[model samples]
Target: MAREECKALLDALNKTTACYHHLVLTVGGSADTQDLREELQKTRQKARELAVATGARLTVALRDRGLATEERAEFERLWVAFSGCLDLLEADMQRSLTLGAAFPLHAPRRPLVRTGVAGGSSAVAARALSARSLRHEAEGDFDVADLPELEREVLQVGKMIDDMEMKVNVPRWTVQARQAAGAELLLSGASAGASSVGGISVQERAGPCDPSKALAATVFSAVLLVAVALALCVAKLS
Candidate 1:
């Protein structure tokens, strides 16, 4: 369907939304662009409205799809890809809107004038002065109010699903450590068995690898290994 609103929205989104990495490394901080920030916020809000309307049409288009299992899967995949794009657009726009509303753009400075409070004639001027003073104070409040908290993730560059993971080196030291742990386990078991048959004193025969102690140690080692594996997985995914 042809839509000017959709076109405008897409254009605004495409222009305003840079790769997270681009924003951080290239665009720098949002501090220096007062006029640009206001314009972007207005553009973002317009795009969001258009997206909500157009997205409804997209949902219907999805429901209308009719295909074989393989083709249907492909169509669904495309839909999902488009949905991800939309989500990124919306999230970035919303992030800017929230921050912009809290700390508005700066206004141009106004000229100041001095007034006297000397007589009856001055009383009229004093009333006008008081009204102007209140207006100036309100403007000052707008400028000096607390700033909002920034979202660090907005600065994080978006990555393709394929870009999330990469091969990592398994250090030789890691292999050696695993081997050492295995050897320690084997020695403990051997000592336990030898003590069982050595005819040593009761307390001495119990040995370093008492059944419970050995089990606990093994379990702890296994847990540590699992924790390490999990940490590796998380690092890769992140």
Candidate 2:
């Protein structure tokens, strides 16, 4: 491929790969999760295979150019390292999946209001939901002691459990929010990847799934790509 074309393809693939890695976290229990896992397996294979193929083609090209023996060996070694990229990607995926599973509930409840509304059924529903949400706010039995006797009796259940869960909830909520946002970036990422060429993208080929993860995986992938691209640029300039 030409330079720009190759860059675009690589970017699209990277984004799609990141998307799947992020998705494995939030989609673990869904019916479609296995499909996501299968897609992930396929993606890792394609990446490894592509790296090998590219390395082979480049080696042949360099050999045809009458490159020095030592230089040729070095080039082959560098390209061979691409196969290990899959291993790194798989490790990141596993780590992110574990972090995602830390929540007590596998799935978050459907949010009360996607956008808090002020009128109609949404307004009434929002009010009702707000009341329910207040239940999460009370920190201890003391906070609920002011309620009716029957309400207080029911509230004691939280005393038994709240402190233990509260510790996890704080950090988990933050992680969950970021994963949701990152997943959004990844899903829409395919179109963003395609916007330049005005055609189908790598994400489309892989198919989309319900999404979320990879603070661990996402950051690593992004950093690695930037590092690799910079190395290539430096090599070309020299």
Candidate 3:
């Protein structure tokens, strides 16, 4: 039972790691590099937390078990592998941050023009060209025109963040499996050495059934029936 529980826990841990990895990969492929980097950093942080939690659970399980030295060593080796993955994730985040920060900000162009006095025909042509240039500059300066694209990108990033957060908070079935396994392990341990386990008394294990309470409940039910019968008899008599 203990082995089964351990296997369940390990399976859950693996599933969680896989889910997190998928999120990381999806974030990596995002077109919006800035948002992607931020989301990747968040994913890495979440992965680190998961690694720590899994490590703690594994340590607890190992300590409670009567495993051979070889088994213990193998568990430690697995932990090391998990830790290495976290380290790699952290390093990747650092590299991404650096690369993102190095992206140069380009300044928006300021429209410029110079026109000297010339012949009437030339001046008229130059004025017409100037008018067209001014119209183009006005169009370019309309920041509101870009708002829909910016809004769309923002919504996309927000959806990604929301999806990732939901995945983190939702309880995985592996967790449920691990819990069931752990409960079975504890119950089996209790059954093996019932007398030696001193914390919970046997009576407590028997739960809350009481014969006196059962008798009282039975008596009350009988009395209620008799009373209803008497009332019906009185109604018939009347």
Candidate 4:
């Protein structure tokens, strides 16, 4: 079971890393190209799918204890590879947004100024001013809108990976330390038949599952939902 899970995790990780690399390259080349909008949309969609799939596999691997030391080491290597790629992609995206590269910016339309009105001169000026103000406000909002939300989605995905890495590492190190201590105690002539160690009974050591697992799962689900919604919005905008 552990071997199978490890294989699945590696497969997902490989695909995700490949997708990330592709995204980084594509964005680098086409950030300012207006004609590549559809290609960028497709690339983003593929990347999102791979990211979500890889994250799910990673969560399962962390939950299962079937992975050996070497397998876990390989997993970490693959994770770091993709995580770095994600960071690069995010940085490129930020740069693109700042330069107004990826998304096209249209000039705000100038309000038409009416002249030679024979009546209500002050009232006409007030109404034109109000219209101009509203148009400016709407244009300002639209120009700055989508970039932040997209940036936030990237950050959220990074956070999810960081949290999962923490969850796996903490328990793994604790188990290794306990094993090392046990080995030392035996070498130093501690009783081989001791029923307990460090004031912890066998039953206590085998206690219930960690509560953080549920919380992490919930967080993962919410992030995935937000990602999907953001993808849809981007698709529509494109």
Candidate 5:
């Protein structure tokens, strides 16, 4: 039963590593996030379940009396690998969501409004319109639709990481080193052999902010100013 649990744990860790790699590749591309998001959810669920099944038994599994020295070492190695893969995956996914949230909720492609002014008036109006659009674009009008889901995902991943850390007193190695050793083991298809585990410092998650009322007021003022300027220009031309 212990051996079966070990194998299943190792397999789950491998799955996590694959998911992390896929996440890195997907995020670096222009592909839609729907698939990536689903995969993340599934992988996280598997990881949480694995932790529940194995965390309570880790102490016995790692004890000198439980298994041979070699077996205990191997178990530690897999734990290290699992920790590193999960750390990298969760950190990267959080970053992607944070950056994604900075984008405008709905960007409508709008052409500049044309006005019949044969003089410097047309130039002035165009400049005003461009400036207004640029300002709003910089304000970062985010979509709250995905914000709640992202926050929930982040919280779940964090809890999973924290739970494991509390359960296992692994070495405080760097994430890069753990990942490197894990990668080497995965590539060589050899027995796991490593001593490493590290936690990343997660940033405080920000809730969604609504700037619609302020944005609407800004837009209204800009439009009114443009209309007034255009009317003045037309009056002067006449």
Candidate 6:
């Protein structure tokens, strides 16, 4: 039973690590030029799925006493790996947004002005101004109008990325805490088991003689024996 539980824990931890690696790769691939928007969406989806799977596996491992110390350490390591992957994802999103915002779209036309005649200069200036105004109006109505909406969408996505990052890290931290608790429980169980084994050895060495003295020794030894057995049982189960 203990061996089986240890195997399950190791398997779960392996899966968690693989999922975290996949997340890191996905986030890193976000920079690929082809179908960037789609890639980003896919990366986010994969990260979310991995985070959920890791949390579920950790919960299952926590419920079993047969989990091994090495398995617990692996689980903690996977949590750290997942947390690091989430940080990379967040950073990647921020970098992509910053790069996208750095380059503004160029204006459709260069500014133009005409001057030659004293009165004609004014007329040409007026005509030039009118042309500029017309160009601005057309571009303004067609393209510039969407800039604010585009910026807002990007900001919204950034916020979502940040929120998801936090969600992923929170579960990893929880798993780490559970791993620590499991370690403590295993150590305490081992200590109790050793103490019980010691008492049993002493009792066996001192052969029965007086009724009252033997009864007291037997009772004391029995308690220690139980403690040792319980500890061994826990260790085996874990």
Worst 10 residues of 4 by lDDT: 28-37
Ranking by lDDT: 5, 4, 6, 3, 1, 2
Candidate 2 lDDT by residue in tens digits, 90-155: 454554344333322213564221333446687686685664345544433221222233233223
Instruction: Supply every candidate's count of residue pairs whose N, Cα or C atoms clash at under 3 angstroms.
Output: 2, 0, 0, 0, 0, 5
TM-score of each: 0.31, 0.26, 0.32, 0.41, 0.45, 0.32
Q: List the candidate 4 regions with Cα displacement exceeding 4 Å.
A: 1-33, 101-104, 109-149, 170-238
Off by over 4 Å in 6: 1-34, 59-66, 104-238
Q: For candidate 1, what is the total of clashing residue pairs? A: 2
Worst 10 residues of 6 by lDDT: 110-119
Best by lDDT: 5
Candidate 5 per-residue C-alpha lDDT over 7-73 given as tens digits, one digit per residue, 9 for 90 to 100: 6776776676566556645542455233444565566556556644554555467654648866666
Give Cα-based local distance difference scores for all models: 0.46, 0.45, 0.50, 0.55, 0.59, 0.52
lDDT of 6 by residue, 15-121 (tens): 54454334334322333222333344455555545555554554455455676877765555554554555455455445544443332233346312122223556
Please identify which of the two predictions, 2 or 4, would achieve the higher TM-score against the true structure: 4
Candidate 6: lDDT over CA atoms?
0.52
lDDT of 1 at 113: 20
Lowest lDDT block of 10, candidate 1? 160-169
- Please give, for residues 1-238, the per-residue lDDT of candidate 1 as tens digits: 3233444544544444444313322111443233344345355445445445544433443455363555444334433433455567646644553544444444446312212344568667667567656665565633223222223223222232122112212222322221445788899999998987676667576656568888999999999999999999999999
> Model 1, which residues run further than 4 Å from truth?
1-16, 19-31, 65-74, 97-238
